[model samples]
Target: MFIEYLTNLLGTVYKVPGTIDPEKSFLELEVDSLSLAELGAQLADDLGIEVAEEDLSSTTTVAELAGLLESRGADIPA
Candidate 1:
């Protein structure tokens, strides 16, 4: 669920390779710091919960991020 949402959030960017794989690292996916900040805001707005960028950086995959959201009790679409 989170992988799909995150994939849609990321949209598309040239020079980035691979699909939004659950196992792929965000850093390896070419997600920049600015994008991370934007993602933080988007998550807060959409989930009604805010998470620190530094906290997010510890995770390396879409699946991991989904787990983070789960751990925080954030909403995840079915």
Candidate 2:
């Protein structure tokens, strides 16, 4: 669930069409630090989870970010 949500959010942040690949790194996605910060804010606001920009920066991929959000207590649908 979080993966799907993150994928959608990443697409919005990156202004890209189609689904974002979970295995692709942020660098490969061409995400800059400013985008990371914006993504972090959006995650916190949308998920009600305190995701620091540094934490988001540390995440290598969308899947890794989903794992981090899961660890931080984001809801997982079954």
* Predicted model with the maximum TM-score: 2
Error in Å for residue 74 of model 1: 1.5
Error of 2 at 30 (Å): 0.8
Off by over 4 Å in 1: 12-18
Cα lDDT for residue 23, candidate 2: 88
Show pairs that collide, candidate 2: none
lDDT of candidate 1 over 1-78, digit per residue (tens): 677777766766323455677787778777877777777887898898887877667246778887788888887644
Per-model TM-score versus the true fold: 0.77, 0.80
Report the C-alpha displacement of residue 47, candidate 2, in angstroms.
1.3
Candidate 2 on 13-75: residue-level lDDT in tens?
567556688888787777888888888877777778887666777347888898898888887
TM-score of 2: 0.80
